[model samples]
Structure formats: structure tokens, C-alpha cells
Target chain A: MEFLSYTFMRRALLAGNMVGVIAPLVGVFLNLRRLSLIGHTLSHVALAGVALGLFLGFFPVYTAIIVSILAALAIEKLRRDYRDYAELSLAIILAAGLGLATILISASRQSAGIHSYLFGSISLVGTRDIYMILPLALVIIAVILKYYYGFFYLAFNENEAWLAGVPVRTLNVVFMVIVSVTVALAIRVVGTLLIASLITIPVAAGMQVAWSFKSTIWLSLFFSLTAVNLGLILSFYYNLAPGGTIILAGVVILLLVLLVKKIWLLLRRDL
Target chain B: MSFLKVEGVSFAYRKERVVDDVNLELKQGDFAAFIGPNGSGKSTLLKLILGYLTPTRGEITLKGQPVAEIMDWTRVGYISQQVKDFNQSFPATVREIVGSNLYSKMGLVKFLNQELEKKIYRALELVEMEDLINRKIGNLSGGQQQRVFIARLMVNDPELILLDEPLAGVDIRAQDDFYRIIGNINQEMNKTVIMVSHDIQVISKHANKIVCFEDGRAYPHCSQEFSYDDYIHDLRRTNLRIIPRHDH
Candidate 1:
């Protein structure tokens, strides 16, 4: 309780909780649309951006933002042009970004940049970083809530939505942009390596028991907050990496849900 | 003028012509079925009508205006054969699925308030699915899914409804219910319906008109003299080898 009185600890807690909330909220749609892999791919692209920023003498966050948006555009264009081979296109972009990062890192004079981005140092997060991430997360969440129906329609059945005048192409671009923004904002807390888990695990856990779309979203948000808060507390106590621990906690919870669901089914049959 | 006029329309995939030199017209409030064996371009023609595919030659006009110039899409509703293509485990409620039709009408920035909620309830009620509004789409049976899709279509208040194989994979009781529901939509609402069906016997019994497809062309059969027995005999005899195997 004494530790919670510190401003730094409070700031870290707030930031971690915000990220945990936003990631899974967006993730419910991402998982449904089968775009979970995009999270991983964009995080790797951010890694390249961070490495490039170190070499070019710019703010890594700004570089990460630019690189992530570019990756999103490339993904959207690739999917449109090669709709039949979209998966291959995603793989190619992911590989290219990672390869660029590897080359940049090998030629760099300093190694601190790679280490910081790989394993996020949440304790080192500044007030400036919090200010940047908070509004971005808020705006993205607000936009998503406003256009929930359009996104749901487009994700479920694109052709039917198109015929009903849903501006399918524009919505697709907007959705990709949202994903890019979330990945960019999450980099400080979750890092590039395990950010996708923050997006995927909560939704996976919620799906085991959710019978409705609205309930599923709420459940995902609950699981995500629990994992992040718990993981942060454990990390602070044990002096471990917050992002990795949070992701592991989420996975464990998801497995437990699956186990419980299976047991319930078995018990019902026996009766 | 016809409610829908498709003139000299020809469509091809890559280099293979699927609908060749075809012409069709449907009057307002007509309930018509397009029937044929596999790959006979029944679905292709419907796609052309819905503006999903471009014709290599000629144009499609809706109510005297060219379909390309028509910006109002709320006037049309469509249901595809691939509703089951969605992930069975996707997290969406039956109400959400039905309510999705309102997106285009409400635009992106609008919120779904109490009035809209009432409309969603009404739409679900029409399909007799009001009680299952909170149920996940994945949990519903095939017929139920089709009904939910119908409820989605109804919210749009379309002048024309295009359905692709709505009866496929639905059980007999569900099919009867579907037919009755469609009958009510046509008779009560006076909405034009164009459907693609393989059940020639059922189509003969229920559909007001039939459009037969063979060798990449569509021919309309007048309901007054159309015989179910003769039509079945001709269909079975003409395409014996290509007939798909039936499980039941």
C-alpha cells in the first residue's frame, strides 16, 4: 500500500490498466476477423522502426508510428491486390520488416535500443509517454464504439454489407488504421515481442464462455484487466518483466477456462 | 418499364463466359425463382443483377436508371448461399447480426438509441426470433441462421430482395416455415423477390414464376401453364449425368 502511494507506481498502474483494456476490446473484433496475426506482424514492423530510429537519431516512438502505419497500408493494399494470397503477403511483409531490423541491429554501434524494445522497461516509462498513449487509446476506443455496427457487419459478411451500402473498402482501411494505432500505443508497456498475446489471449479466454457478442466483449475486457493488473503486481514484487508475465498469466487463465468448460460439459452429460 | 432490366448482359471469369448474351426483366412485386443444375450460371445472373460482377457487354438498369448511376443501395437487399462461411465460433449475437443492416442507414458516426433498439426488436419479432436476440449466431441452426439473415434484410425495407439458395441444408419443417415467411413478405409487404433454387418441385408449388437456366441462358415460365411433373421430367432427363448425388 505504501508503494502504491508513489506517483511513478500510480502512473505505471494507470498506463498498464489502460493498455490492458484497449488491447482486448479491439482484439474481440480482430480475433473474429481472423486478423490476430496482424498484431504480431505489425509489432515486428515496429521493432524495425525502433532500430531505424536509433540509427537515424530520431524518437523511436515517432518512427514506430510511421512504420506501423506504413505496414498497415501495405497490408491493406496487398490484401486488395492479391486477395487470393493475402496470407503469403502478410508473411512477406513480416519477414521483410524483421530482416531489416536484424540488419540494422547488426550494424549498430549500440545495443541498448534493441534490448529496451524487446523487453519493455515499464519502470522507465515517462510522463510524456503516458500522455501520448492515453489520448490515442481513448480516441481509438471512442471511434470503435461509434462504428461498432459497421465493423461488425463488414467483419461478418463483407458482400452483404457492401450491397447494403456499408462502404466496405473505406471501412477496411479504417479498421487497419485502428489496429496500427493500437500496436503503436502498446509498444511502451507490452513491447514488440509479446504485444500480440495482449491482443489474443483475453479474447480466447472470453470466447470459452461467451454466448453473445456483447457479453463476449465484456468478458474479454474483464480478463484483460485482471491479467494486466495481476501481472503488474507480480512483476513489481518478483522484479520480473511485466509484459511477459502478463501474457503468461493470460494464457494460463485461458487454459483454465477451457478446462472448466470441458468439465461442465462432462458433468452435464453424466446427469 | 420493367422494375429491373438486364439487357445484353454477358459475364466471364478469366476467359470463360458464364452468362452469355443474356437478357432479363422483372416487374415490381414479382416473386421469381432461377433454377438450374450446377454451373449453369443461375447464381452468376443474380450476381450481375446485384452489381457484384460487371458484365463484359451491355448494362443493367433498375427502374429506368442504369445500375452504375444508381447510388441508393438501401433499395436492394441480398442474401448469399455462403452465410455459413462465417466462423462458427465468432462472437456476435442474433440481434447484432440483424441490427447490422442498420449501419448503412445510420452511417458510421451515429449511435443505436432506444428507437433503433425498438426497430431491431421488431425485425426479430417478424422472424419469430425476438426471444433469441441475445443468442450467438454460431449457436443457431442453419434454418435459424437463414431466418436471422431474413430479419437483417427486413430492417432495410428493400424494394427488392435477392436470395441465393435460402432453402439449402434446411430441414423440411424449417423449409415450410421459410416458404411461409417468404410468402408473407411477398404478399404482405409487396416486395420483389428473386431467388436461386434447385428444388424444382417446391418452386413449382410455391413460386409465382420460374426462370429456367440451361446452356447459359434464362427462360421465364408463365405460372398459369407451368407443370411441376413435366418440368421435373425434363430437368431430370436433360441433365441426368450432371445431377448431384442426394444424401436423403
Candidate 2:
């Protein structure tokens, strides 16, 4: 109970739940567009940005946001340049990001913090981290809601969206920018390694029974928040790593949902 | 003035011209069907009219305004033949799919008002899909999905509707239903329709104008003015009989 009152624990919870909500929200669109791997690639780029920022003495999260946005634009350019080989863009950038991160981590004497960036430590989240993450989560949520119809159209059928005069090129750039921002903020809470799990696991679970697009989105957010909250509380009491615990919680819930759906189908058959 | 015009239009992929120096004109209420063998650039020409591809040589105009300068895109609706290209597992309801039409024409600011909701219902009613608004799009049959797409295109009330092989994979009964709906749109609603189809007999039965493409060149003819036998012979002679030429 005392741990709940601690500022570090409170901050971690706030940041975790925010990422919990925003990751899956953006993730639903990414999954629909078949761009889930881009999230993993951009997180590696964010890791490189964090290492570079720590080495050069800049705010790591903000530097990550800039680096991620640049990397996203490069990915977009490469995708255009090699339309048939779009996945190659993710592969190339991921390799470069890991190489740069390794070099920067070796150069910096304050490399102890790099451990937190890799696996994530709730104790590492501070007041400054809260301030940075809050605004980004809000902005992403706002944009997703405001341009909900346009983004849905783009995800469903990009060519049709273009024919409808939906400014597809500009909207695509905006979507990547949102992804970059989410990746930057999420790494601070979930770490670079497990961030993809947080983004996609809940979405996968929600998709098991969600019959409509709107329900899928809402159910994904519900599953995400449930996982994060349960994971945070259990980890605090059991002395387990929050990031892995949160992801595992999401996985457990997904398995349970699948089991329940199967049972329901069998019961209906008997009736 | 013509409702839509494509003049001296040409498109190429690295020096191999697909659509070459094509000219076409459509007026309000015109039911024009573009017929060609595979690689004859029928779909390419339709893309040019929708501004999906810019012609390498000449220009296209909509209502006396250049295609590039037209701000009122709601005046045109395009249904691509790439319906099979859509992800089958994508989650959306019929209402959501139909509602997406408002985004391109209305932009980001206007929220879904009562007027837009009513418009969507009216469009779905036109396609006779008003009852399935809440059904999952993926669960629907192919014909039903195609009708939903038509409703999606109609939500904006466009004057010129361009469809590329809309009935390609649909069953014969559904194809008949589609032709009837399109015919009603042209004759009753007085909207111009330019459809690309390989089903020569069905299209010739309904279309007032028939345009044939051969060797990257387009030959437009009034349905009453051209000889079907000559066209079939021309199509067979060029080794362009990919889809089995329909004979009268």
C-alpha cells in the first residue's frame, strides 16, 4: 500500500496506462494497414536516438521523437523508391539503428541508464517524463479521433481513398508522424524491446470477437488498460519486471478470450 | 460543353505506351462502355479521367475546368476494378464503409451531422442495402460488398460515375442487378456513367456509346453506328483475345 503512494510508482502507473491506451489505438490502424513491423523498426530507431541523446547531452525523449520522425520519412521515401520491396526499408533502418545505438552506448560513460532503455524500469520515469508523455498521448488521441474517417478510409482501401480525393499522400505522412511520436513516448514506458507487444497484443485479443471496427477499437483499449493496470499492481507486489509482466498479462487475457469464444461456439452448436 | 473530356492523352511505363493519344467525350446522362482486350488500356484511360494517373501528352477536363484545378471532387465518383485487392479480414460495417465517402468530399472539419447520416441511408437505399447497414462487411457476399461500394460512391451525389469492371467477378444474377441499378442511375437520375467492361453483349445492350481500344489506340463509336462483327474480327486478329471474345 505504501508503494502506491510513492511518486515513482504513481508516475510509472500514469505513464504505463497512457501508453496502454495510445499504443493500441495507433496499433489498430497499423495492423489494418499491415504495417505492424514498422512499429518495431521505429522503436529501434528511437533506441538509437536515446543513446545518441545521452552521449551528446540532450533530452533523450525529445531527441528520440525527432530521430523517429526523420527515420519514418526515410522509410516513406524508401517505400516509394522501391514500391515492390517496402519491407526492405524497415530492415535497412533497423540495422542502421542497432549499429548506431551500439556505437553510442559504448562511447558514453553514463551507460548504466541504457539498461533501463532496453528493458524499462518504472523507477526511471520522472516528473519530466510525465510532462513529455502526457502531451504526446493527448495529441495522438486527438488526431486519431479528429481524422477518424479519413484514416479509416486510408486503412481500408488507399486507392479508393485517393479516388475520393482524400489527400492520401499528406494523410499518410501525418500517420507516420503520429507513429513516430507514439514510438518515442512508448519506449520511455515499455522499453524498445517489449513495445511491440504492448501495441499489438491487445489488438489481437480484441479482434477475436469484435464484430465491428468501432467495437474492435474500443475493446482493444479496454484489453490494454486491463493488462497494464493488472500488470502494474502485480509487479509492484511481486517484485517482477513491469514491462514483461504487462505484456504477459495481455497474452494471458488473449488466451482466455480465445478459450471463452471457442467454448461459446461449442455451446451454440449443442443448442 | 462536355461534362468530361480526355484529349490527346497518353500514358507510358518506361517508354512502352499503354494508353496512346486517346480522345473521349461524355455528356450528362451518357452511358458509355469502354471495351477492349487485355492490355488495351481501358482501365488506364479511366484512371486518367480520375486524375489517378497524369497523361504524359495531353489534358483532361471536367465541366470546362482542367481536371487538376477542379475543387469539387464530389462531382466525380470512381469504382476501381481492384475490389479483390482489399484485405478480406479488414473490420468494418456497411454503414462505416458508406460513411467513409463523406471524408474525401467533406474533408476533416465537418463532423457527421444528421444531413450526412440521412444521405448515407439514401445512398444505401439506392443500392437496396439499407437493412444491412450494421452487418460486417467481410461477412457479406461479394455481390453485397460490391453494392455497398456503389452506395459508398453515391453518398456524395457525384454527377460523373466511373466504374472499372465492377461486375467482373460477380455472378450473373448479381450482374443483372448491377446493370439495372446503373441503368436506372443513368436514365432516371440523369448521371453520366463511363464503365470499363469485357462483357460486350451485356454492355452493348444497355450502353448508348461503345468505345473500343486496340493497340493502345481508342476508337469511339455510337452503339448503332459500329459493326460488332468487324470489332470482334479486329480484336481476334491482334491476338488480343485474352478473355475469349464474345461473338454475336
Error of 2 at B112 (Å): 2.4
Provide the lDDT at A106 for model 2: 96
The clash count for each model shown is 0, 0
List the lowest-lDDT window of 10 residues for candidate 2 chain B: B239-248
**Model 2 alpha-carbon drift over 4 Å, by segment:** A1-3, B105-111, B222-248
Q: Please compute DockQ, using alpha carbons, for every candidate against the native two-chain complex.
A: 0.64, 0.58
TM-score of each: 0.92, 0.94
- lDDT (10s digit) by residue, model 1, range B50-157: 777788998998888877776777777888888668888787888778777877667457456677778889888888889999988888998898899899888878
Candidate 2 per-residue C-alpha lDDT over B1-248 given as tens digits, one digit per residue, 9 for 90 to 100 = 99888889999978999999989888889999998777789998888887767889989998888887767677788888786578877888888888888885454562466778899899999999999999989889888889998998899999899999998779889898898888888899999999998877789999999998877899899455556665666667776654554352
On a 0 to 1 TM-score scale, where does candidate 1 land against the true structure?
A: 0.92
